[model samples]
Target: MLVPLTRQKFNQLIPLIATGPQYKYYWGKFPDFLQRLLISVVIAAVYVLVRLFAMPGFGPILFVLGVIGAFYWLWGPVFWASMRNAKCRRYKYSGFFRGRVLDWWITDELIGKQETVDNKGDLVIVENREKRINLEVGDETGFTAQLRAPLRVEHKVIARGQKVEMLVMSNRPDLSKIEEITDIYIPSRDLWVSDYPYLRRDYFPEVSRRLRDRPSERPRRRRPPEEQKGRRVEEWE
Candidate 1:
């Protein structure tokens, strides 16, 4: 299922920039207003220090840095999405390939420790562990790849021998080879498991269906010549 990068597809993907679990896991730790307040305080403190010391030409530099930081903090997700989308365009061609899960395993990774006051009024360190699932998948072409993603509840249903689909990029027009592969999309569960989100969920299904329904191409065998037909001629001595 070859899907070309188009303006329409790109537009469809824009809305999903900060909507995935990967983004939520990190940014959700703090409220957006609190994060904004922290950034503002940091910028104001830097400005105060620069002014108090009377640093020559540092005011303009601080202003420039503040603007850049503010822009990034506010629109970082969209900026990142645009950059990644641009990078993906270089692949030019991509196909949706179906593969079966050969094996899978779960691991608990320590993300960080947080300081908290337990009900006892004593400060305690709470460990934050993110459950991750590692999967091994292989397709008919004998191409196998491993994918790792945060183990959300929807992914708990994954088991060995389950069919999964992924979008593979290739320079070849026929998609004869795999250059890179995106995260796996589990149709049965309507779930996408990946460290990063790549495809437009709303559009991927329609493209996959169209490609699967299209006729496959195969070379026709050459027929024997009329003179050579119905005869077993001996090799020249």
Candidate 2:
């Protein structure tokens, strides 16, 4: 049972949108090759030792064991690294629907900030400020939707005052899917710093000047009466 988001809930989620730290594939090199070579060498050495001890059959068994060990060692790291990368990857989407349909695809931070607990022990929270989403286990009744187990969430800290965007979805009454809450439009360091040196420095400063300043309202620009009238007349025209 998917429900439309209200305006008030949408406004609350505006602050949660932003990009996150880029993940680097650390084991993208030939570490596995070295591990396999090492295993093969060890196995061959063991086979030679067994042959010298009058055990010809043991040599073949050791060779087979070595081959199996080499494969396991070679691919084990690659498989584990790939799984880690996939789990950390983020997805963002626009809207949600009922009956196990695919929603939007997001590549940003999604957060579930718990706001309250209902009688059934479900968590009710504001999802991206567009709607109040709930998360709970068990049957979906008197609720908009429901999500099963295996829910995940991630938390990150950015420089304060950084602009972010957020997307929220209610998979179940107790679970609210929160998406990336950072300004994705901001260029990455490798991109901007290499091409635009001056602009790069402005993107991320060690000490934010705005944070150092005392709190003060920005001065409002006063338009002249004639300009205001002109703007109004232009709107009508």
Give the top-scoring candidate (lDDT). 1
Tell me model 1's lDDT, rounded to 2 decimals. Answer: 0.64
lDDT values, one for every candidate: 0.64, 0.32
lDDT at 20 for candidate 2?
24
Instruction: Work out how many backbone clashes candidate 2 has.
Output: 37
Q: How many residue pairs clash in each candidate?
A: 0, 37
**Which prediction has the highest TM-score against the true structure?**
1
TM accuracy, model 1? 0.62
The local lDDT score (0 to 100) that residue 187 gets in candidate 2 is 21
lDDT of 1 at 96: 52
Worst 10 residues of 1 by lDDT: 228-237
Q: Write the per-residue lDDT of candidate 1 for residues 88-121, one digit (tens) a residue.
A: 6567555456768889999999988999998999
Which residue ranges in model 1 land beyond 4 Å of their true spot? 1-26, 31-37, 44-72, 84-93, 113-127, 170-179, 216-237
